[model samples]
Target: MNQNLVIALAQVNPTVGDIDGNLARARAVRAEAAAAGADLVVGGELLVAGYPPEDLVLKPAFIDRVEAAVEAFARETADGGPAFLLGAPWQMRGRLFNAALLLDGGRIAAVTRKYDLPNYGVFDEKRVFAAGPLPEPIPFRDARLGVLICEDMWTAAATAALAERGADLLLVLNGSPFEFDKPDVRLDLARARAAESGRPLAYVNLVGGQDELVFDGDSFVIDASGAVMARLESWDERMAVTRWRARDGVWVCEPAAVAARPVGEEAIFAALVTGLRDYVDKNGFPGIVLGMSGGIDSALSAAVAVDALGADRVRLVAMPSPYTSRASVEDAAETARLLGAKLESVSIEPAMQAFGHMLAGLFAGRPADETEENIQARARAVTLMALSNKFGHMLLTTGNKSEMSVGYATLYGDMCGGYSVLKDVYKTTVFALARWRNRERPAGALGPGGRVIPERVITKPPSAELKPNQTDQDTLPPYDELDAILRGLVEDERSIAEMTAGGFDETTVRRVWRMLHRAEYKRRQAPPGVKITHRAFGRDRRYPLTNRFTDLA
Candidate 1:
């Protein structure tokens, strides 16, 4: 009789630095997989200490806890349930390596170190753990498992080495973050590895948010022919076991049902909800508070908050100034009513008047300019911060990527928040997301099913409402054009000549380029948000605050 195996893919949401809590979650998942009669259960990268443990790995005490917890978890294999393959930061021979440990028969059977440390984009593993040598297959019951960590599966070298050494199945553990177009990319890489190695492959990814990054748990399994057999859901925790049988001296995963996953705007909204939810919950914040200005960005941010943390957990504040329109005030009220969230109005007029009177002497000869406009913004910031401080809710900033990109947002005013949901989303995408959320209720969303955001808010022209008859286009270009130009400069890293050559106005392109660079310092101080794009503002994209180089065409 040929050998057969049951492998379970466990996608879990782990909080960084919560060693004991993470292990408890893993144990619970293992128990569920065992009940399904699985022979081996595999989890995502760094399941013990959490992925990208970052500088947490620098502390010897943190490493000690991880090693001790791992040893203790290995001993639990004596229960005769499914053996566990988990990832953690391992310190061996006085050097730490991001490692995958195979636990069977009550001891640490084998350890596979991550040879490829991703150092680009949001990854900085090269600064932390030392890269290990190419890994070999580990022998398990009835099969030799080729284990590849997150970055290891991106290239063919690791898969080739494992296949040459007579490995039967390729298993990958990933902490891959969610980019708009990343799900297809991950699947392609999996198919490429399977076709090249001529072996079936299984992938498991960590789900949930870690700071600004959110991982979509669309873990999947592909056969030797590079066809996907089983697919998991995204933006949530899931566990599925696949049956495998030995055929023609190779292992093949039995075909399982593929779950439908969210894509495009739906996927981005899910990422935002997941990121915001985890950030607030993981940080132990009781709720979220934000200035709901009746603008699309704040309306969408409020909707996400209600969807993520529930209406009872979200508090909306309307900080109206003299410049705030009646439509805006009404829209803000209607938005809160639709979402069933708590709302309070605090006019910034008193603060504005006070500041005006205080600064009238110094501004005796100076005409009113953006300086006065900025005072209104700062007043709103103070009002929101006061509420957040008094009531235990974390402040959520609502500025989108477009305003943030062109330096249209105030530094300490609108940017003052503990976190942001639209920090990485551009203005045009923000409009699209708002429209989508109104029509569709995302999977696992807690808010109402229909139209949490007001229709007027979606169609109205965007503005800061600090001055009369002022609109966003009054200071900047239209969002569609602005986003297109910014995408080339920020996401594609195109030069000024490249942007202008692509049918963009040269002056507009150069002006947008200057704004992008000038806003680096502002972004540095901006709250962390969901990273839906390939080039997010924070850890994903880095730039000097003071730079002289401008790619003038």
Candidate 2:
């Protein structure tokens, strides 16, 4: 029996389409593991090609480059340091599959393909790659390791088979995306697998944002008895090394440090910060510029931006219209001052007058109504966009999920931006996040310590201020009720009757259901944002732009 072994879990951040950079990152981590005397270094799924290569896997040239890079990195193991267990898109006999490779002794020692390809919500792996047959335990030095890809661990078939085959350890490579309370779900699943197989398990997950999805790197190890032996930090890149020993023909992971995981609003806030930070940094944007209307939505957006990219990189512009209140202006200024971000006042009154005059002739006798309010919103949009263009900064939209659920948002007005940090965050969660940020600054946050958002920002009535005395409640239900209703309609996919049965008014349910379907066209054009909920607007819940079917019954 082997006296001792060391395994290092590499929680990495890889950009999709940056094949060379991804390989370089793997090499750096492998070197770090070698310096720490690790016997093997395990990485997250598709670390070579950067998880969910999407259609990039379709290109023969892209696959060719990835293969060459993996082979090259495999050959580097000839140095006799630490062996690497890596993941990449592999081509075997005219078909592509998600695979994990064991690199040792200067060659590819073993290969295991992913048996389960997830196809539901935010995952379309079935369309891109074929599912491989059930994987067998791969042979390493003294241990036969049971390997499960991200989705493979969700089911029991793979784990049971590997355990029956006399495998000594279970290793999982994951590219799991972040959702509210998903960390707990993953932990529960891992514990179940460990208890069923009677084998200790090691899980490695990717970190950082990819497009609208963010991966929380909460890599952890569970003992055979379903106890956590080691846990890594979440929302950041880290490399955790665990020591193991073979005792009485069974492998036991020696007790190691367990880092605390964020919960509730704290986890959601970290996801927002990580998502926005990676989106701006990975896309090569110098900084971000957004409209600060002193409303809860924009105030929270500014605080997230300042925390994500620092105050210097965040520029806040107050685009006040005639209907904008003095209290709102003061709140915006105060929020900026607290966050230490630069704020510039840009009145859209001139643009409003120009648009009013430009459309006066066409309006003829039409009385001013929501059309005027839309013009005001568009005028503000133009002002913020001009600054974004001149300063080479990406525009950050601040509309929350509640406004977007119905048709309350103006398309091409408040919806225009390079990215949105709060797109998936509901109005109710927005208030919670604002209050949390004011009291506590998250770890690795670049913003100030005490309070980034003013207390008044959270307490004030939520409004868009597109017109005089405009509050969100005038067009939509109260946020708490609206979010609960939306959770049933969108997340739970319940019918109007079902929502009504769930203690909501039937009329309000019908009205919300209609607006949700009618606004599909606008949502299609909304910018990408952090997906914190199980059912975000983009890839998570896609609806047809032209549809007549309603769940009214």
Candidate 3:
């Protein structure tokens, strides 16, 4: 009788520098898979010290810690009921290579180093890892399996090399970050690579939001005919075991379908909400607190917080000033009530007047300008932070991506938060998600009745309420137009000429670029947000902290 194999793809979300913790994670997954009679399990890149550990690999002690933990893992699997294949940074001959190691029978079975180090966009793998030679697949039971780390599978050479070395099955471990429509793109790539390798492939990815970037697991398997046989859920933790049959002396795969991931606003909403909840929970925060401004951004943030934690765990402050309109105050109040949160109003007028009188002498020569406007924002910030300090609640800053990109926000004023909830979400998206969230309530929504965000807030022109009769359009272009230009330039990497060619007013295009470039320093200091795109401001979009690059096209 031909031998059959059942393999488990463990999509593990590992934390960096927590070697013991990571190893424990590996063991737990391994034990689960072994209990299900699985022959092997695959984990993602840098499963030991975590992906993008960056310079942590430079420390000899860190590497030693990883090695020690790996040895301990090997010891725990001494009887070797299930083989483990996972990525880790390995050092030999005083050099580091991005490696995939196979552990079985209390020892290292084989280690394959990554040959391709991506150096584009957000990746700087070449700087950290030395390229290594092509590796042959490890033969076990009835299948010859080749292991490739993240970057190697992106290129055809590694697959070709493995095929030339007589690999019958290909397994990949990935730490791929989430972007709009990336799941389909990844599935297509996996299919092509599997057909090219002339073998079935199993792909496992790490899950969870890290800083600005979120890794959506959604690990999958593709058959020899390049048809996807199994799929996993995105942005969530899941485990599944697939059976492989030995048919006519060749390995064949059968898999289970992963529940489809949420799409568009729903997907982005879940990512942002989960990002906030996990960041707060993992960082040891008691609760989340934010100021409700009757603005779409804060309203969405409040909804997310209430959805993430219970409504009881989310609190709101309404520290309105003279510039804040009556309608806005009422809207904020109603929104808070809908979200089942007890809203507090701390009038910042006294503080504002006090500060205004104090700054009278210092501003004697200056005209009344944005300084006064910023004073209102600063007053609100101080009030919120004071509440946070008194109650030990983590302040969740509410500023959408458009404002964050253009220095429209006050630095210490609105940016005062333990974490920024929507830093990666653009203004247009904020509007859409606010409407969408109101339409479709999350399972744990705190609101008792109708949509929390009022139709007035959605339809009304956005305003900072920093000054009388002020609106966002007064300082910035309409959100639709601005987002069009931004999507072209930032996401599509279109240049000034490209934006101009795409029917944008040349002057407006150049001015927007200027705003984006000038505001890099501000974004650098802003709290991290959920990364729903391929290139979030923090990890993906990097610029010189000090640079003066302006496009005049």
Candidate 4:
């Protein structure tokens, strides 16, 4: 029995349904860990088949392939240098379970199933996987290692049970998705469990984007005292190593390199970048093309695109309509110049005229209203979509969450795109992020640093510019008030009266509430975007399109 154990956290990103590729990554990382003198290596949750295989796990053939890959991984350990603990879905007695496989000495040593199945907020594990009985510690070399899946570690009972069973250390495998401030929340949970169990805990999280969910791998290790011993980088992939030693009859992880995690808008910005990069790259898009409205939203979106896919890969089109101000056109060009993205000018006036002439007789008696405005937006959408098709570039929509919240955007118009980078970002937060990116270029940003977003764009009023003297505030409340009300209604799920009592106007709150409800259908059809906040439109917060229920009081 070795008194000292070295563990490596193989924080690799796995694509959903990529069994062979994921197994190759696991094997390669294991070889790296073995070279580093690690006694054992552990990967993130469901590493072999990727996290949230969704309905793919329901197929028997997929499960068989995953199990075969796990066996192949086990065979690689025959060199006897380091053991591997990885995750995969297994079927036992005709029941599917999310199990962790322990491979040592070239064979599968033991298997432990996930006890807690999370069924809320982007997770439907209960539907796909059967919850196993409480997991006990598994023997590895000379140490009894307690293994817990993602959701199991959130509660104390699992870790406490392992401690009572005389587990030497706790290892948690996670497919945790990135949300604002989630890293802190995860560390707090881990610290609480470590304190209760009086044992060192190592948390390894998956890193990469899967559909709308982006897994920020902020893998970490904490000693018995709840002090963070080692921390891995977030929003990127890295393999981290932690050394553990038994001291005074207690196993404690020694101090190691701790990477500083991004906080607030920094983390959110990184999430948007990672999510967009993975969504575009993984889906095999040649590059991205987006309409640069010269407004804060599009400016920020272009900046993010440039940062994610590089300036050469991002194409900026300034589609000015009859109402499009000269200032906006100039601003859009300047923004493209600043970001070094290729800017093309396309006038939507011809399309607008074409649509107006086509609808003139039908709309002859009716006063020109939002219908006319939507035509302009739709024209822009058509031009962008044409370019997207011709050049094989993914059209990036630029609507922020505030507009998406209140049905403020035009369907099949501004909302037409393969992805929306700022779909989950509020208008106020968009300004904040624009300011942040101007001042600091965070790690992994490929764009040029220093004032990339013009200050005028941030200070200018927001508008759809659909009509004369048009601004977002004319149809909706001011962004500050609107975002506050939205946070309460959407994220906090507060009643209208609750929001009004909290210093918001009753009329404004009710109006916002109505708009939010009316927008459900639009959101259902909108393209998937990166989720930065606690509650995003698609998965995190789901609302019925036909619901007549209102919380307005």
Candidate 5:
């Protein structure tokens, strides 16, 4: 074999329930690897039914379908070419097990069960399948390979057992979601595992967005000495092939060099575009539609939509109200023009006046209040829904995480959409991305070519422009301070006492903590958005809405 053993890792996007399509993709990738003369090829975790299958894994019929698919796939691999290691659920002895199937020459080589099914933070594997026994190393062609599923490599005992079992290399398949610096975190883990076990490591990750999760495909292989040898590109469908040579009885992996990683805002922007595109295309949606506001959030969402779906596929409607400013109207039109998407201006002023005039008697002497504001929002919602129904487009919402967290968004107003683009992004990140997208060209941009957002959109003060002279800071804290507090409490899990001790104003912390707790209902009803962290609302983080527990704990 040319004095080397070649291995290929395929990180391709797969839809959740599209069983036949996903299987076709797997077979196609396997054929590609075989064509490349690879001795072994690996797919991401749960290749049959896709990852984070959630309640679908609980159904007996779905499990049967998965088993049928797995068996069929194993049979197809009998062409006797390269060995294949893939993920699937194994129904055995009246109990379901999260499993990794090893296929060679059209026969079942080994079925390894995952030991650690992550229970917390964007994972509910524990709820779906029973944990399997510790995995054993499978030997093939002068090397002992240890196959571990997504959460199995995260635990100590799994890798420890593999090390003690005289394994020559560690290969892990994952459906890990994307977050800032998540790739670096995964690399650090890989390095540590390699150094600790004194073996080379191969990490193959899935690439796609399923519902709220966005899987970033930045797979890599590291040497026994804990050095990266090969890295696949981020948020892309990359197939990498490398050879390992047993030099002096030590398995050493040699891979081709790849390009550098993206940085900061560019990195995040790329992830968003990739996530949105995959979610839309893989889900079989015809196109996307959203109300175009002049705010940075909508402007940036439009930019991302154009980058994800072509401009022709993204329909923008400038739905204005009495509260919408002239500058806002101009900016919204400008954003649509820059994105090259079809634009239609439907003034909500007439609808607003009609609703107000109709409800004048019921609201007599009540004066102007949040109810009035909400009515304005609902009218716009009806109009948007009408347009969406007539045009057969998937409505895209533009609420950012900060506004979602604080319950600053109206339920039937800005929240009435099929998909949310910026629901996971904080307001601070929204501003940064708007500025970066305007000043810099994002990776994989598919719009008219130059900068999508104008400089004035980023330079201008952040506002909803729902009312005359309206600023977000009027009702909400500064974006910088609010994002800091959220990261502390939400991500880092800092207690209220700890947050106050960390230099935050005491009253402010307590007040914000209450708002976060009270806003649970709002988040519960909001449409699912991209999840960039280990913990995201609706799926990952399940805080009790009626609970009395406070951050004071």
Candidate 6:
């Protein structure tokens, strides 16, 4: 028997529910792999129907169409150049399954269904697909290959079963979403699995943006000794080929070119860019327009938009009120100029005055307070919305997670937009991203390089500028302290007592917790944004608006 194999990993992006388009992409990639003399071509999980088809899989008609497409793809392999392993939904015995098919010789040779279904934190696979039975390795050209779909590899049982069944190599397909530090976590898991099974492993992950989730395709190959042999680039689309040969009675993969992975803040920034770009282009938006206040949040949002869509497609509007400082105006203009985007100045003084005059009679005895400040914000929102309507540009809201955690943002005002670019980002990280953009521009960015965000914007005290000498600190805790408390409550779900014992002030923690619970109503109405953390506000954490149960313990 031949002891050599060539496998091509197709790291292509697929739009959800675009069956025809997805199949075309698959055919194109399979042709490329065949030309390269690969023995087999493998794709990501759910490649035919796209990952997370969600409730779409419940429709029998959709599954029929997907099966038809898979058959058509299988027929094309009759030319005998390369075999294909493609992902699709299968219906058998009135049960739906997430399945991978082996296509060779103008027909499907075998099928493997997913054994494990993930149910927590942006995953509801169990809700849509029935759990498949334990799988056996399939016979290939010269070896027995074991297939593990995504979550199946996270546990040791599946690998052990495949190894016990005499599988020679393990191939894992994934639709894994990108999170901070996820690459390290994935590598560690692969190493452990390889060590346990005593076989080489190949992993291919889906790449692209799907609503709030961004899949960073860091596909890799590892030797049985638990060393990385090849790694594909993240945040981009490409096909990586790995060659294997049997030596000393053990199959080993040859070392190939490995792409470096982005880490920390850089990985976070890349995710943001990919998420925004796909949302705009896939949704068919003409361009994007955002309110460019001189503060760091808006500055960072504008930079991300320009980088994702280019300076020409990004429009910046600075709506200054009576309390808007000259320094703010200068900073906004300077930032726009540096990024090579046009800044449109729209003063909201007249609109604010008109609203105040209209409400003067109703506020005869009430003292002027946050109500008046909200009027200024609402007026700016109206101006921005008008531009969005007239120009057909998608409005991008710039509120960060810190403000969203507390009841700090005005509803129907700054929160009014088609999308929230910084909805999942913390205020502290916002400042850091602004500085990072100035230092280094990311790859595939369309904007001009060097100091995209002005320095003063990063150093200045953050403010809504609704009143004289107003700063965020007047109404909220310092960002560092506030963010720490927020992570404890929102991400970690820690109790008030726990946070206090961890060196946080009791009174401050209680106050922030109260604000966090009170703002659930606002967050419910906020626009969708990219999720970078493991526990983002939207799909990850769900809480009732009327709940009075406080974590005083």
Give the alpha carbon lDDT tens digit for every residue of 1-553 in model 5.
3346899998978887767778888888888999999999888988778877888888898888887877788887778778888888788899888888888877788888988888877788888899998889998888888888978777768888899998888999998888877878888888887888888989999987888788888888999787789888877788889888886657888867664777688878887887788778876777888888887888899999998888988988888887788888888888888878888888888887888899999889887877878877777788888877888778889999888877889998889888887888888899888877777766667866677787677778887666778888888788899988988877787899899989998887887788888899888889878877666677777777788876554
The lDDT values for all models are: 0.92, 0.91, 0.83, 0.90, 0.83, 0.90
Report per-prediction Cα RMSD to one decimal. Answer: 0.9, 1.0, 2.1, 1.2, 1.9, 1.3
Rate residue 276 of model 2 by lDDT: 95
Which regions of candidate 2 deviate over 4 angstroms? none
lDDT of 3: 0.83
Candidate 2: pairs in clash:
none
Tens-digit lDDT track of model 2 for 1-553: 4567899999999999898999899899999999999999999999998877899999999999989988998899999999999899999999999999999989989889999899989999998999998989988878889999999899988999999998899999999999997998998999899999999999999999998999999999999888999999999889988999997669999999999999889999999999999999999999999999988899899999998999999989998888889999999999999999889998889988998889899998998998888888888788888988899999999999988999789988999899989988888899999888888989999999998888888898888887778788988888899889998989999988778877899998888988889999999999999999899998999888988786775
Q: How many clashing pairs in candidate 5?
A: 1
> For this target, which candidate reaches the highest lDDT against the unseen true structure?
1
Error of 2 at 245 (Å): 1.0
Q: lDDT for model 4, please.
A: 0.90
lDDT of 2 at 464: 83
TM-score per candidate: 0.99, 0.99, 0.94, 0.98, 0.96, 0.98
Total backbone collisions for each predicted model: 0, 0, 0, 0, 1, 0
TM-score between candidate 2 and the true structure: 0.99
For 144-209, candidate 3 gives per-residue lDDT tens digits of 888878777888899999888888788898988777678788878887888887788888999876
Sliding window of 10 residues with minimal summed lDDT for model 5:
254-263
Model 1 scores a TM of 0.99
Q: In model 2, what lDDT does residue 70 have?
A: 88
Worst 10 residues of 2 by lDDT: 544-553
